[model samples]
Target: MQWNVQELENWEELRTYVDTALLPLYLYRPEKPVKEHVQRMSYLVQVAASIEQRLKGRVLMFPLCYQIGDEPLAQRLPAGFAHYVLLQFSGDRLDAHEGEGSRLRLTVGDEDLESALRFEVTIDVLSQEIIRHWQHGGRQ
Candidate 1:
């Protein structure tokens, strides 16, 4: 379930069914042009939505956390989650895939930026990877 007052009210009960919290971090360059920033944000939202749709009952998707240029992330995270997965999307690099600890970073590279179909496919594959990791009890 998405983060909201209604859902938050049932958080305790929801906790019983879900073991993982999925946080989507949208990282963008404040110095970039408006059009570029918007495009990147659009891609981030679409990818995040895709993940939420596929894993609706199993994971709780927190609201999008927008970060500007290396801003600290620790303070933005919600408390009480022992199994948390951070899915980060950045527009400034081609180093699209990286995973360590509980965070996975995907770059909105040229290929994904050029075609919506490719972008969706990339999101699907990444989402599946996350689900697989979670099902196997997360990282060791």
Candidate 2:
């Protein structure tokens, strides 16, 4: 997965990564009704659209809408897929490293991040980076 120091070179690559890596992860929402896919997609759109604003000049965002098959990757999609609809980032890469779970090497910096919350909020509560910063004590 080694990300060469090239993503930050321009906006095109940033969009390319999102198209290639993020879209397959959750595009269709297999659990939802066909009619609901549009609503689901709209929600995903709002989330994905925010990255550029939050990150400012640090990262560029890809498209919010992508079409994907309505099934899990292991059963229908295949291996090494984008896994659905996902927002992607591209920027100047620093280097590559062994990732936490997969064999794919990842580049350093925000460009390498693949947080799906950029597309939805369900997992946001558990993100360690967020939790660590947000957790607080009450009258304990």
Candidate 3:
């Protein structure tokens, strides 16, 4: 599930099955070129949307959160879900540490950015990680 009006309409009913929250983290470099930021964020968003589709009933993907200053990013998330998955580019500036629940870091590195096949592989790896989190009872 995603953070859209359609998906959130039945929040009360979906709340019980959705125990994980997927938050995409990206760096916001104001001085950088606009195109660069858009390209990077677009890729991350695509990857996240695919993941949410694969794990629809169990995960709710939040919007992309771009880090501006040195503040903690994970702190932005509410304290409700059983697990929080931080999706980000491997070389992004912010490395958020979750203070609550089981936190999982799913990164997409340069090597994984080559083509559609690579992106699919990245998604597979990330999906496995999330499944592993559930198997371990939402532990590290």
Candidate 4:
């Protein structure tokens, strides 16, 4: 969990690795229910783990993070819906001033995602598992 200046300087490169790693998860979208959400998240984790191995210098993958109330409706309604996609960097490394550092607001959504609200709701439920693993260290 050490980030040296040299590695930090190449912030764009680092961010690319981050983006490249997570993009796939959202591209295709996953199956129903939140259980499969982890598969998508695993895509992001795999990216970070891969980057951690090849890159040298400073750079740490903090821990997975997700928020329960990114959307007002989801929070207030308390009904079934897709939750927000949480973006947890290894301690906000994505916020770096590098070229295009990690997305300021991290969200894992598929590229060809349906242009509908329900799809979003689906992503939310599964997000809980992502947060759980980051905090407790286990699969969904």
Number of the top-ranking candidate, with TM-score as the measure = 3
Lowest lDDT 10-mer window, candidate 1? 92-101
lDDT of 1 by residue, 37-100 (tens): 7877677666766777787776677776765676554434455554566666544422212223
Encode model 2's per-residue lDDT on 1-140: one tens digit a residue. Answer: 11234544564544434322222123453565876655555544444444233433322333443435543333222133221222312221122222221222111123213455433343232122222322321010
Write model 3 residue lDDT over 10-82, tens digit each, in one string: 9999899998989898877688788877888899999999999999899999998888755656555557788
Clashes of each: 0, 17, 0, 10
The better-scoring model by TM-score among 3 and 4 is 3
In terms of TM-score, how similar is model 2 to the real structure?
A: 0.34
Q: Is candidate 1 or candidate 4 better by TM-score?
A: 1
TM-score of each: 0.72, 0.34, 0.88, 0.31
User: Would you list the clashing residue pairs of candidate 3?
Assistant: none
lDDT of 4 by residue, 9-103 (tens): 76665553332212111222233456555654565555444434443222244334333322221212112212222343222222211222222
How are the candidates ranked when ordered by lDDT, highest leading? 3, 1, 4, 2
Q: How far is 123's C-alpha from truth in model 3 (Å)?
A: 0.7
Q: List the candidate 4 regions with Cα displacement exceeding 4 Å.
A: 2-32, 72-140
Strongest candidate by lDDT: 3
